[model samples]
Target chain A: MGKLSKKEIERVASLARIKLDEEEKEKMASELGAVLDYIDKLKEVNTDGVEPIAHITGMENILRKDEPMKKPLEGQAADAAKLVKMAPDSKDNFVKVKAVFGE
Target chain B: MIKDNILIEGEKCTAASKILENYIAPYDATVISNLKQAGAVFLGKTNLDEFAMGATGENSAFGPALNPHDHTRAAGGSSSGSAAAVAADLAVYALGSDTGGSIRAPSAWCGVVGLKPTYGLVSRHGLIAMASSLDQIGPITKTVEDAAIVLNTIAGYDPMDSTSHNGELPDYTANLNKPVKGLKIAVPKEFFSKGLDGQVNNLTQAAIAKLESLGAHIDQVSLPMINFAIATYYIIVSSEVSANLARYDGIRYGRSANKAKSLLDAYLETRAEGLGAEVKRRIMLGTYALSAGYYDAYYLKAQKVRALIKRDFENIFEKYDVIVGPTMPYAAPKLGELGDSLSAYLADIYTAPVNLAGLPAISVPCGQVEVDGSKLPVGFQIIGKHFDEARILQVAHNFEKSRQ
Candidate 1:
């Protein structure tokens, strides 16, 4: 309902961990503000007693067995290796990144 | 063309983002597995909006997929390339994911048949996640029967996707031979409001009249909560998108920001550089909505409104077999015509609500309109109840048969 400031946009982008350049920041601030302002109409609807419908299908807590199928599991493992190998740097069968233990 | 976002095993599934340009799909999604078992060929992957974020074809990182009907216009997206490919006969048929209106909107613009199956009716295993709760992979084809054929191949239970329906699958083509006489159809008045183009409204009404003449009953229905659809859809989807897209940190896969000075920079810069403008925009908005202080106001409220939208459809389906309306507001806009994200978001007015309710809806070409010196196709959408795909397909097929 309230207007979004540039600072708020930047903070949200940071929370999302997606860096926005100066131009993108102002643009995003305005665009998201418009969308936010538009959806502000939700406040007009009195949802005081309504329960939130998270999924469209009424099914809840669908649990497949934890055991994996061998064929697809192997295939998925191979694909995971291939994806890992795609990173900028991979060593010893893993993607290598900047050392996590830095000052 | 190589894909920007489709998940073909070991193939690039960039999802039209700089971040995932190198991201190879880890395995075949459940739908892809079904298609493979049916002996479907691997035509090269087509284009889509980055992270499946926009309404117009203009948002793809690769560039807009041109409408075959009017080259100067968009192909309608985020299933832009799939619809255009089918329209142009570039592929026999193509798989498209409809989170909100991606499948139906593109089909309308391209003059094809696109079916967004009941949310859980089709498996979402291999399809790249857009908005988890709303996304469903469906088919875009040249005919209703063809759409039915593709649906038959892909619809079934897949343990891989916990959301996949465990119900018995039907031969979608089996009911195409059935007639739709005496079927009750409702036209939601909210869908025909002010912004609907006059030509489109006329054509849609004409299509309904023709349906009436075919022995089906048509009635104008009021769904008071219809006005809240776009607002509710954006809030819920953006919130989910923010959560789903967070896995794109540099370490796992996709294009990593090797230049990051620290692990946190890797997350920030990778997403910043890899994602497109519309995608980043949704992420920011979603993040803001889900933030601790604002969650109740935006995300939770949207879900409650979503419940109301579902109830509206439920009440209508209680009387009518299917609900009919125009798919998009009008024909495809000229490439780059909608200059802002809000306009594109608003453009999805008619299509998104069906997704929110998790029902099956199909866009069948009703007729064409001469606009801006070129002929553009108009689509009429028929929405059916959950898991009631057979009836809608039968209705659409009957309509298709009547026209011919």
Candidate 2:
């Protein structure tokens, strides 16, 4: 059975880019560990010859014809505007964000 | 009626997540577009588990959707509101997304009919991405015929969703009159194993017997790999979730954190405040699994096991027309009954396997069980091979008609 230590939880939390408080980290350490422990049973299955598949649908390389755009948004300014307006901080057409690096 | 809530222009498609709270969709999802062309009236969006992550509706950022049958019981979820609405006659039918039994579980718990179409059978272009490969938009309705009608409207290929199947779709309701007489049905012994409540088991077995009386041939089969379904389903779902949810970085759309000094801080703080505990847990688990050193051991191994699980279904379907079992191992649990995340994941055992195999399955109300003075609904699940929805729907419709 695999157990996630608090440190490992913190590390994974960082990778996920979600801030977790001390209490949450502690809870996740045990809860997630229990789940992983259950999942660890998969190691027992002999999957030597099985090929991993991404999706069950056997379709491959589904390419569509590059047709001229019908432009559903052609005369719909409200729709295009609504798309940008969803952003918390949006200007004319672009969304504003904090500086990536401190000066 | 579209559970495929993507960019429904000028409408809020939150997936019940606070992160996407107040985020209005910018364009119509393909399903919604199809429904509109069919002259379907849009009732309204139903509530769900936040980001469609939890099995119980308790994970909804707003509040858990109560089972219409019992106010204290949970409407099985992430499509919690969809099922509850139809169950209560609040809506004629509603659309719901299912990754691992989101639609069926809730429908079963709420005592309604729910259907999860074959993967790529419906367009995913406008639906919010959960576990992209597993996430499917489906219908929760009052009857099997309604499910078929909604499916007829919403299914078919769209150039927008590359994975969408390009084929001539059948009018699902056309086969409603087909009799189940002589239809071969496989009942996997694993579905009746430990963890299934005794009453639920009895009800399901009786439902199977009823089908047999209708002339369906039933056989007991073993699917040894069934044990690995939940683990494999969670691993694949989480990995895909980690990748899909990464798009919500605050700057693009959705709720953003204020007073962040750097972009990194903005990303972390926004998600921490916006996402719920279960969603965060899945993201972290997925991130850990997909992380460099653990990738081969966890993600790749689960995928291989997934292939085996799929093989199990293929082998069974070779001999049977559809597989029948209880949609849920038990009747609806009271709200907050499932305290831990792992327990909730385990409850998905029977439902998850169908998703892993990209098969079509439906949850039809079989009967009711007495629980704590309440008559809780039991669901009988019928799973069919890939693109074999008509066969299953035929069986379900006949079963439902016979009960009526």
Candidate 3:
């Protein structure tokens, strides 16, 4: 495993969308480096011709047929309103967010 | 019955993180719905490690859940509160999500019965996502019989969860009194290595000896690939966590940042302020593994090695009915005694392999080990083939009955 530099940590943090301070960055550089170094042991195993398993259960293509609306999906309008109301900013039953097109 | 905060719907599902501390669940988790249908009463939600990331309960944003045996020691975690509550007699039983020992470790540390069902046997719908592939919800209870009963109610398929198993399930509580006579049990040599505490090793070996005297055939087996289980588990778990947690981008319902200049800033700042340290660390590590240029080395390699670990168990199960061992390396440690996170991850060696293979395993109280003058509980783990909850539960049940 390569040394996890501060800049690399920052880059990963950016991809993850979690900001880290300089001190946290330094700590993660070492901590994540150690973890990645440990994970590097997988290289010892010969996985030649072995297919990687994404799901353990053999079930595949579990297709559910499109059925008619089952009693309007059970939730009352009050529940819908309450769920929509949970957002920090909302109006007219829609969650409000900053405009995608920046000014 | 108590439920871990990770299960969603009526109450707040904080998952022991500040980001969703006040987030109300919009729907009942499939397991919760199953329990309710069986007339199980809710005793309330319990604390856990943030996002079910840590092995010890210390990583909770609220605070670590204390061990029922010793107040200063940590209850084993991620499902810490549930195990502690059951051990402390605060609830009859509780539900906990296990994605690499979240249920078993805490149950072991707190001296309660915790069963991590085969993946997809219990639906993950409405449960907060930690690792999509390895996660399963199971019961934490005071007795193996109670764990069996709870499993009977909650084990089944759900249309809502595509990964849900549609296979038939046996009555988990039906064979509680079944004798272990003629049952073949394998004790993996790797689980009793030098890393195991001396007292814990003695107690676990004694427990196996007792089972042997009860007419069960016991033999030492080798699972050489077990050495790499923790490394593979962390890589896969972190990679999945980074993807699953991307849903909490401040737009939907979680904590939002104040006065964000742009959507990107809103996401970065909200997570910065809301997520706990361990959660962020996992996300960073996960993102790095799944990032450009490193995917093959970390995520993909881990998955292939995971196949080997799973194969080890499959080979053993071809002959043995179940594999038994100590659930943890040692008893619960003092609140902050786990030291660095790396050491904690390494301690999960025994339990991680079960998750990687998506097998059913239960941790039943074996006895206690004298640690620092305190008699802390040890867990005897019984692992079975995929979807063989009944066999493991029956073996555990007979063991529990024999103790009386």
Model 2 ranges off by over 4 Å = A65-82, B1-7
Candidate 2, residues B1-404, lDDT tens digits: the string is: 44424456678888888888888777678888888789888878888888888888899888998999999999998899889999999889999999999999999999999999999998877788889889899889999999999899889977677788989878899988989999999999999888999999999999999999999999999999999999999899999899899988898788899878899999999999999989898998899899989999999999999999889999998899999999999999999999988899988989999999999999999999999999999999999988989999999999999997
10 residues in a row with least lDDT, candidate 1 chain B: B1-10
* Ten residues in sequence with the least summed lDDT for candidate 3 chain B: B1-10
Name the 10 consecutive residues with the lowest summed lDDT in model 2 chain A: A72-81
Deviation (Å) of A15 in candidate 2? 1.5
**Residue range A1-103, candidate 1, lDDT tens digits:** 3457888987898899988888888777778878888998888998889999966879988875778566664243345667667677889888788867657
DockQ of every predicted complex: 0.69, 0.65, 0.62
For every model in order, what is the iRMS?
A: 1.9, 2.3, 2.3
Q: Model 1, B1-404: lDDT tens per residue?
A: 22245567867787777777667676777677777889888878888888788887788777889999999999998988989998899987888889989989989999999999999998777777889999988988899999899899889887667898988878899988786789999998999999999999999998899889989998889989989999999998899999999988877667778788888888888887788888887888899999989999999999999999899999999999999999999899999898888888989999999999999999999999989899999899999999999999999998888899
Native-vs-model 2 lDDT? 0.88
TM-score of chain A of 3: 0.81
Off by over 4 Å in 3: A66-68, A71-80, A101-103
Instruction: Give the higher-DockQ candidate: 1 or 2.
Output: 1
Between candidates 1 and 3, which one is better according to lDDT?
3
Top-lDDT structure, candidate number: 2
Candidate 3 per-residue lDDT over residues B1-404, each given as its tens digit:
55455454668888888899788887777777777778878878998999889899899999999998999999988799999999999999999989999999999999999999998998887788999899999999999988888888988988778899997788987877889999999999999889999999999998999999999999999999999999999999999999999988888897999689788889989999999988998899899999999899889999899888888898998999999999999999999898889999987889989999999999999998888799999999999998888889888988888888
- Give me the candidate number with maximum DockQ: 1
